[model samples]
Target: MTERELIKKAQAGHNSALNQLLLDNYSILKGYLIKLTLQKELAEDLTQETLLKAVTKIQDYEPRGKFSTWLIVIGKNLYFDYLRKNKNLRNYEEYDSVEKNRVGNQEASAEDHVISGLTFEKMRETLGTLSREKRSVFILKHYYGYSYKEIAEIEQCPIGTIRSRLHNSIEDIRRVMEEEGLDGF
Candidate 1:
């Protein structure tokens, strides 16, 4: 069935339609969550939570955008809320072994090695300085390559707001890089 048909059936309280929708979109939602949270278990849990939220709120859905986009927005909000609640939690600083091993690979040229190190470190520091909303917008736009319209729909804001947020984020990063003489990156 088409998404519109599925949505119509699901809204009418058809359990099978809802289940089919979730099953069809689960992997896409999970992959998106993984990128946002950078953890497998957290991503999986958030995916489930997103699906549940979507099911419960299915009646509110107006088919304004693709169901996948709607699902991702719900997942993103849940992840942000989780971060806000756990803001005071202790920091865990273990480096990912995969990244470390990749950095140590003999195939890396001198220029490639230096550029990668600097880019990664600068990105980490820059990301830490952005407000939650700005960072989320930037990541969704640039890192995830989502369009402004899609982001606005997901964020429940005007398209201009997403554009402004992305502009400010890029300007901030540029200023930081210039100040630190890291513009070569």
Candidate 2:
């Protein structure tokens, strides 16, 4: 069945249709959360929360946008709420131990391995430095390939605000890279 048909069924109290809808978009939603949160376990937690919200609030979903986009909007809001209620404090990351181990030196590696590892870490750090709102705009636009209008709608903000946030976030990342002498500079 088409997505519209599935959505219609889901809205009409077909539990399986709604389950299939959430299952279909689960990976993309989780991946987006991982990229946005920078903390894998937190991403996992938020994914569950997002899914629960989707299940409970399926009736509010409109068909004008992709279901995945709506899921992303919910995920973003939950993350922001978490940050606010927690007073912007994040505890020690259990995922970082794995990340550190992955970046460990390998005897057979060449320049590519070192460059890529450092680049990835630096990029992650730069993004982590952004405010949640700025990071949301950046992730929606660049990471997820969302159009300005779509991001505006998902973020429930003006299109101009979306554009400005994306621009500022990019500028911040660029400045960080330049300061760190990245990109062969």
Candidate 3:
């Protein structure tokens, strides 16, 4: 069945259809939450909360945007709420542990893994310097390949504001990279 059909059924109180809908969009939503939160465990928690919200609020979902995008919006709002309530603190130790535990490419040599890990760490550190709102714009646009219009809609801001935030985010990252002698910006 098409996504529209599934959504219709989900909205009509079909548990199977709702489960399928969540399953279909789970990876996209989780990946987005990971990028936004930079903490795998917290992202997982937020992903679960977002899915629960979807299950409870399926009837309110509109069909104008992709279901994945709707899930992202819900997840994003939950993350921001979490930040506000928790005073915007992130557990970097948890992120580092997660990164270290990630499996390296089997085809690549150990040196490649080390270099890639260093580069990723540098980039992540740079991203950490950005404000949550700016970081979200950057991650949504660059990491998730969201368009400015889509980001604006998800961010609930004007397109110009989204553009400005993205510009500033890029400049900040570029400046940090240059300062740290990192190339390939």
lDDT winner among the candidates? 3
lDDT of 3 by residue, 18-119 (tens): 999999999989988887888899999999999999998899998987898899999998997898688764652231122112222441243233234336
Scored by CA lDDT, what does every candidate get?
0.70, 0.74, 0.76
TM-score of each: 0.63, 0.78, 0.79
Top-down lDDT ranking: 3, 2, 1
Q: How many backbone clashes does candidate 2 have?
A: 0
lDDT per residue as tens, model 2, 21-114: 9888999899889888889999999999999999898898889988998999899889878987887734323211211111123312322332
Clashing pairs in 3: none
Q: Over all chains combined, what TM-score does candidate 2 have?
A: 0.78
lDDT of 3 at 6: 97
For model 3, the run of ten residues with the poorest summed lDDT:
95-104
lDDT at 22, model 1 = 86
What 10-residue stretch in candidate 2 is worst by lDDT?
94-103
Per-residue lDDT value at 85 in model 2: 86
lDDT value, residue 91 of candidate 3: 51
Error of 2 at 100 (Å): 39
List candidate 3 stretches off by more than 4 Å: 89-118
